[model samples]
Structures are given as structure tokens and as C-alpha cells.
Target: MPCDFLPAQRALLDATEHLIYTGGIHATGVDAIVRKSGIARKTLYRHYPTKEALVEAALRRRDDRWMAWFIAATSGYTDPRARLLSCFDALREWFASDGFHGCAFLNAAGEIGPATHPIRAVSRLHKRRLFEYVCTLTRETGLAQPDEIAEEFLVLIDGAISLALVFGDTHGADAAARSAQRLLRHIPVSS
Candidate 1:
């Protein structure tokens, strides 16, 4: 959903996203969100009836923000191939950003137990959107198997994020970019 949040509601979501991103979803509570937001408990609940609902909204907001930033980061290059490879450049910047804990969707999905949970569903949707965007880029490059190349690229993207989080390896994205270049070299371009 587009963030058409009221001032108070936006505050609540900003606080929720920060706390959850830095501290994990299960560990962060409504009380902390209320306090951090400086919005009264009643107001928080008024905006989001349940804690889960607030989390969902916050994750949605994060998804919108992350995707916009990512698209902007990669969209500058005119060449489809450069634009595709710029994905890793974007990741490198994100991995180095302050309070970068890893992919928000992955973190939220990990904390939630049920496969059918709304939070997990949101996570899946975020990944699906990202993958679809990659597909568009690969197809634009005239790759013979754009879908297959997209799948490999998405794996590299996820692997870079995971390795960066686990090892504090700032160069993970660079390595992923190199691997992507190698993958592109092997894949036959369409006539």
C-alpha cells in the first residue's frame, strides 16, 4: 500500500519499522513502538487495531521504500546490462547503510512461524515483485532465457544480502556482482 499515513500514523510506522529492523519483530513490542513513536497507546491502537496489523503496515511501508530506492539506484543506467548489474551496487550501498540488519522481508518471515501468516505473505509478495522486476530487466537485455537468468540473479542477490548480514562482509555485493558478470557471460543472448 502507498504510504498515505497521517502524521501520527506515519510516526507509528516509522517507529515500528526501525524497532523491528534493528531488534527483530518478536522482540519489539507495542509498548516500545508507542514509546518510540511518542504516540499514546490509545492512538497507536486506534491507527492499528492489533500489533500484527501494525507490523504488516510497517512492512508494507518498508517494501515500498526499499523497492523505490532500489529501482532508482539501478534505473540510472541506459544499458539494460548495466542496469541489471547495478542491482549489486545498490545492495552494496544498502549493506553499508547504518542499522542495516539485512532484508526486512527475510527477517520478518524468519520470525513468523506460520507459512500462511499475513506477514509471511507480505514477505513473499515483496520477493515476487523483486523477481518480476529482474525478469523485466533480463528480457530487456534480450537474454535467450531471461527467466532462467533472472532466477540466478535473484539467488545471487539474496546470497549477497545473507552473507553480508552473517559475516559483516561489506564486499559481499561486489563478489555477487562478479558472479553475476560471469553468469551473464555464460548465458547466450537472444538474436
Candidate 2:
């Protein structure tokens, strides 16, 4: 409840985040995270009472840091359309990294069968915020029926992630951009 984690705990959480995202929650154990982080087992347990707590912390930590990476990836884009494309590009970079798993939200959703799981709730909220942000961007772009445009982007993004994971190729990210461009063809844009 201290909000700020001590250095060792932070280190443990950071390592756990990478492990969980790269491998999985159940697949990665406390000892592995501790070893990977070079932190003591007692210290790890001191910060995280249970693996579930550690998993939650890992998810929150990853999400908190990801938005910054995403923002930077789209920072120079002059158009909202390009910003959206850049957003998926960031995802592609992540997916094609040396050790990539799939989407954290999607992964958590699969691990969590119980509706009451905190991680599941957080995943849902995270995804909802993403959709809302996409919709807001569509609105700001002066596009018609912005909500519909956002929904299309949502589908395209999800499909892209799925394909990228399915084929272990980054081309899905490029394909997703194309799919978005095609979807946007119906609406006319003013210069």
C-alpha cells in the first residue's frame, strides 16, 4: 500500500513484467523472477505476498510504462490517421521483439476465468480506455460518425495482433495499416 515500491521490489516487478509478458504468469515462477531480477526471495515475497499480487503489479507496471512508449512512437505524426498507424507500429515492435508474447490484456483475459479476478477487471478497463481513446481521436479528426471509425480501427488492431501472433511475423502490422487505410476510404477527408 506504499504506492512507491522500494528499489528491490521495483526491480522484482520489472523483471516479473518482462517474464510475464514474454512467457506468462503461470509459466514464470517467483524464483525465476527473483533470479532474473537478482533480488532476494525474501525481498520479493516482502513486496509481493502472492504470485497473483505480483502478476497484478506486473500488469499495472507494464501498462503504466507502455503508454509513454506509445506516445513517443506517435509523437511526430501530424495526422490522427498517422498517429493511429504509428500506435500499431509500436505494437508491432513489441510483438517482434527478441522475446514477445501476445497482448497482455488478451493474455490475462485467457488466464482469468473468474469474473472477479482483479487482473481481468484491469484488462477490461485498459482495453476500454484504448477504444475510447481511438474514438476520441476519430472525433477530433472531423471524421463522420467517429464512433464507427473507432470501431473499425479497433477491429483492425485486434485482427492485426492476432495475425502477428499467429504467424510470428511483423507483416500483420503492415497489413493492419493497409486494412485501416481501406476502411477509411469510404469517408472523404477535407484538405
Candidate 3:
């Protein structure tokens, strides 16, 4: 992973992210990134020695940006349980967004075959962060078995993303949110 990026490198990363998000990691070639970034091939190589390196960096960038966006989106609700439920609301909004192409990490994972692949590691890291955040929310809400609840929430979130992608609609989020509500109904919310 790059500790820092030069202006040219930033351009390359941005272009690579856009291309990979819109297209797939394997489908977006180095030439495409260079063309989209308007950066020279030599400059790109200088910044990233290999395509895998560039892909990993782009995924890292997406993970940071996406997580920040999600946190901000869900931060508006004050109640702990509301905050937990806000995740699904945020997902619905994202699903309806113009640039939404499903979870970038999930998409990348499918494209990167090997479990040992660096891109796969990036994908796993993204999910782990998401799960941790959900766990924090569940704990704050005074939910019993925070780990289990968080795991369930993560599953619903991922399932909603996958369904939204497959159906080309926001109903998946709605369904997931409803299911989540039912799941939480049995758990006592902290006052």
C-alpha cells in the first residue's frame, strides 16, 4: 500500500477506482487507467510497479472513502437503536445513488479469485471494519450477544447489497431493514 501519492499517482488511483468500480478489476487494464487518468504509462509504472499494486491501492482508497461516507450517513440518528437501523436506510440511499455499483469490495473479491490475493485481503479488511462498526452499534444498543447480532446485521447488509445489485432496485434494502427490525424486536434496546 502507498503511504502517500503524488499528484500523478492520485490521478492514476482515481481513474483506476472509477474504471474498476464501473468495470471490473480484471477488465480495466493499465492502458485504460492511463487513458482515463491522462497520466503516462511511464508515470503510472513509476508510481505503482504492478497492476495488482495499483488495484490494491485503489481498493484501499475506496474502503476509506466508502466507510467514511457510511459512518457520516448513519451518524445523524441519536438513539443507539436508531443508529443501528440507520445502516439500512443509508444502504437504501446508496442503492438509489447514480454511481452505486454495489459493494466495491464484494465486486473486487469476485474478480480476484485467490483467497491469498492482496485484493482479497483488502476486501476482507473492508468487511471486518464494517462488522466492527456494527458490533459497536449493537453493543451500544444494549443488545445481547453483540457479536451474534453484529454478524446477523452484516449478513443482512451484504445480502441487501447483493439483492439490490441483482434486482436493480432499492427494495432489497427495504426488505433487509424490515427483517432487521423483526430481529431487533426480540432484543431489549437500552434506555
Candidate 4:
């Protein structure tokens, strides 16, 4: 609810994010988070109450930071079509980045499979926001049925990311981009 986190809270969150990304949700315990953050257990409990709560906060923070990065990366293209395609380029860059470990949301979902888990809820929220962003880009293209096209585009995007992660192939993004181009060609542009 509150974006304004205290110094200790921020530290704990940062530690959690790094640890979870490096190890995993189940592998990274609260004790590790506290030790890495240099925050006492009492302080962590004061802020988060439970490990699940801290995990949710970390995922939320990551969602915010990742979306900001993605939007900024795609902003360079003036044309809506080009901007839409640029998302794949961004993914390629991400895949090639050091310490790249695939989509955090997907990873979190896999690690915490229960549908009712708070972390899974956060992952779902992140995905919904991604779909919404695609819809925004599609609207800018002045295409017929932007919402439907955006949904299809999101499927391609997610599929590409999953393929890249599984096969360790950056070219998957390019393949996805080509498919996106084909999909875009089918949608009639507004006059």
C-alpha cells in the first residue's frame, strides 16, 4: 500500500529480491534475507509479519521496476508499430543480461504453484499490467480490435520469453518479433 519504504524496509526488500532471483522463493529463507540485509529479525517482522508478506513486497517492487524499464526501453520508437515490436528487442537484451534467470513472475509462479498464494497473485497482477501495456501500444497503432490483437500479442510475447528461458536462446525474441509483425499485418489500420 505504501510506496514510501523506510531505509531498513528497502534494504530488506532489495535483499529479498536478489536472493529470490538467485536462489528461489523456497530456497531463500527469512534468515538469509535478514543476514544479507543486515536487518534484525525484529525489524523484518515489524515490517512484514510473515515471509509471504515480504515476498509479495519484493515481487511488487520488481514489477514496478521492470515495467518502468520496459516502457522506457520501448519509448525510443515514434511509430506505434515499431514501439510494439521493440518489446521483443528489450526481451532479447534482458535474456542476454548477466545473471539473467528468466521471468521473475513465471519463476515465482512455478515455485509457488498454489493459486491462492500471495506471490502468485502478485505474479498475475504483473502479467495483467503487461497485457494492459500491450493494449495501450495497440491503441496507438489505430488498429481495429486493439484489445483482441493485444491479447494475441501478449501470448506471443510470453511464449517467446518462455522459449528463450528454456533454451537459452536470445533469437527467440526475434522469432517472436517476426510473428508479431505478421499478426500486425492482418489487423486493419484505422483511416
Q: How far is 144's C-alpha from truth in model 4 (Å)?
A: 1.3
Q: Report how far residue 135 has shifted in candidate 4, in Å.
A: 0.1
Residues 26-113, candidate 3, lDDT per residue (tens digit)? 8999999989999999989888999999999989988998888999999998898899999999999999999888989999999988
Residues 45-111, model 1: lDDT tens digits:
8889999999999998899889889988999999999999999999999999888899999999999
RMSD (Å) per prediction: 1.0, 2.9, 2.0, 1.6
What is the C-alpha local distance difference test score of each model?
0.93, 0.79, 0.92, 0.92
Of 1 and 4, which scores higher on lDDT? Answer: 1
**Worst-scoring 10-residue span by lDDT in model 1:** 1-10
Residue 50 displacement in candidate 1 (angstroms) = 0.7
Ranking by TM-score: 1, 3, 4, 2
Candidate 2 C-alpha lDDT tens digits along 38-141: 99888878888888888888887776666557667666677877776676787788778876666788888787889789889878776777788788667767
- TM-score head-to-head 1 vs 4, winner: 1
Q: Please list all clashing residue pairs in model 2, or write none if there are none.
A: none
| Clashing residue pairs in candidate 4 (N, C-alpha, C atoms within 3 angstroms) | none
Which model is ahead, 1 or 2, in terms of TM-score? 1
Tell me the lDDT of candidate 4: 0.92
Between candidates 1 and 3, which one is better according to TM-score? Answer: 1
Candidate 2, poorest ten consecutive residues by summed lDDT: 66-75
